[model samples]
Target: MSSSRYLTNQFLIAMPGLEDPNFFHSVTYICEHNDNGALGLVINRPLEMQLGEIFQHINIEHADPDIRQIQVHLGGPVQQDRGFVLHEPLGDWEATLKVTDRIGVTSSIDILQAIAINEGPERTLVALGYAGWGAGQLEQEMADNAWLSGPADPEILFRTPDAERWRAAAASLGIDLDLLSGEAGHA
Candidate 1:
């Protein structure tokens, strides 16, 4: 696969044919992609718990009701217990993977601490776990039409409602997923 084909900072909109329980109808933000594999966070699946629950679990006291009510997303099926903070303005963080100059995903607790007190990045999407693919695995999925790939849009990531992200992401590519068949074609 050509290096130019790497999907970092892109959106992987699951194809209608993808039947996996974890990814069906999901729109994943590709954070890192290279010869090693791909790492992404599913943006659409919000868990029942809110940010307040996470603060309580981590023993961080926060007084802002707006911050506490933020919905936490289920990023993917992998490492479901770990927290990942995807934020904009890419500030200095302990363990952040800079996907682009504008966005970063931080796993360190310090970012969360700052978040609890409203001193963190201006826009953040807090999630648990992440989507990962081994070397060549994602390429194969692409060839098999498992997803529609396109440049990542911050509006969809930071502002779009969880329930609409799937369609919104596909729409970004001029695709109406509702019209697509749940069957793959071999050209």
Candidate 2:
């Protein structure tokens, strides 16, 4: 596929018609997209877990109550045990995928440590696991109308409340999701 077809630094808003429980009304931030596959993080599904809990599990010291209280999101159904930090400013890290000039997804302890110390990026979204698609899988899903794709906006990823991201992301594309039918059909 050509670069124009790639979805890197985009948002995949799950269509109302999509029945997949894992992605119903989800807003995913596409971090990487290529011929090999696509990788993203679901930004709207917050888990019961918190950053403090993860810090405890990882044996890291988190002294900031605000940072510790930050909710952790369920990024996807895959690798549920792992953690990913979607942050802005793209700081240097051990393992980070630079999605764009301003954003990156890091899966390293160093970033967590920085966050714990109040030295991390200006904004962040912590999540577990990630959404992945094999070669051509995401393209096929797009063709089936399972998702609405558009350029990703950092405001939606970092500042929007989890409950509002789905509609907000769709609205960014001039779509009011509530007005769309829940059933998908081809013309």
Candidate 3:
């Protein structure tokens, strides 16, 4: 680990009129930030699939009543078939990656099973994909005004309704989505 962490657990709010079909109006939760690059989940994009559907596909018994009704989110463009669970801070799982003091991400089946049984972290968001960038790619995009960065709010990550997450995330940075423009250039 680097002595200085970049922006782990921050929110990467998409600028208005962004042309990227995958990220327009997106609110991403940074899971890892280092020299290797960054990884995040797009919190506002919802797919047609549900959590129960995913569990069944993986042969994991969905015995817990609570998770059956949960909606699965489109985390990003990478590994669309994989599962990533962003949850309230609980005891560390074998494969858990601590994004912040308050949040943890678990990508292993054991965590999924624990979640299926209601033995997992109390607050959680299930995603089926993730956003990633090569070295310096994210920084270049940020420099081009492709994204706005802000502190991540746990409430926004786990409790805010999907439709509202984008605006909510932008609002956290004092940015009004309606006032933003996509064109990027030197002033």
Candidate 4:
């Protein structure tokens, strides 16, 4: 098999006809890719939960309404209850995963508090879970045309509207999303 490391920290844009309900029109950001497998976060799927709701559930006082209004995203299918904050690189944290030079994922309360205080990283998207693929599963999926890979764009991930993320990511690769077909089989 080829090395998965090459795809690390890349964007995996779902093909036009992806049948999987979970990944249909999904825009996933590959956080770690290696021989073991790949892990990523679905950046485009936002859950109904809001940051304020989460703060209330966790008993964390959210004094500022702005912080509470931040949308909570659906990170992935696994560990749906867990939280993953994809944010701009700033401040210290307990467990932080640097997704790129401009983006980082923090799973600590400190980051949350910083966000509540409006003193956190300038760009951030709070997710409720993360996507995971077993060994070689992602590579196989990519080979099968289930996804298109491209470089990560902080603006696309954090700034672009969720409704347009799929097209934007594909456009970054010079792909016209409408031209893509769902059928994975090729001649």
Per-residue lDDT of model 1, residues 1-187, tens digit only: 5657899999999988899999999999999999999999999999999999999998999999999999999999999999999999999999999999999999999998998899999999999999999999999999888888999999999999999999999898888888888774421
lDDT of 2 by residue, 65-146 (tens): 9989999999999999999999999999999999988899999999999999999998999999999999999999998888
Candidates 1 and 4 compared by TM-score, better number: 1
lDDT at position 154, candidate 3: 89
Off by over 4 Å in 4: 1-5, 184-187
Q: Ten residues in a row with the worst lDDT in model 2?
A: 178-187
Off by over 4 Å in 3: 1-5, 184-187
Q: Write the per-residue lDDT of candidate 4 for residues 104-174, one digit (tens) a residue.
A: 78889888877887888888989988999998898789789888898988889899999999999988888
Query: Model 3 reaches what TM-score against the true structure?
Result: 0.92
Model 1 stretches with alpha carbons more than 4 Å out: 184-187
lDDT of each: 0.94, 0.93, 0.85, 0.85
lDDT per residue as tens, model 3, 98-137:
8877788889888888878878888989998899988888
TM-score of each: 0.96, 0.96, 0.92, 0.93
Please give the lDDT score at residue 155 for candidate 4: 86
lDDT of 3 at 144: 88
Where is model 2 more than 4 Å wrong at Cα?
Answer: 183-187
Worst 10 residues of 3 by lDDT: 178-187
- Per model, state how many residue pairs clash: 0, 0, 0, 0
- Model 3: per-residue Cα lDDT at residue 143: 82
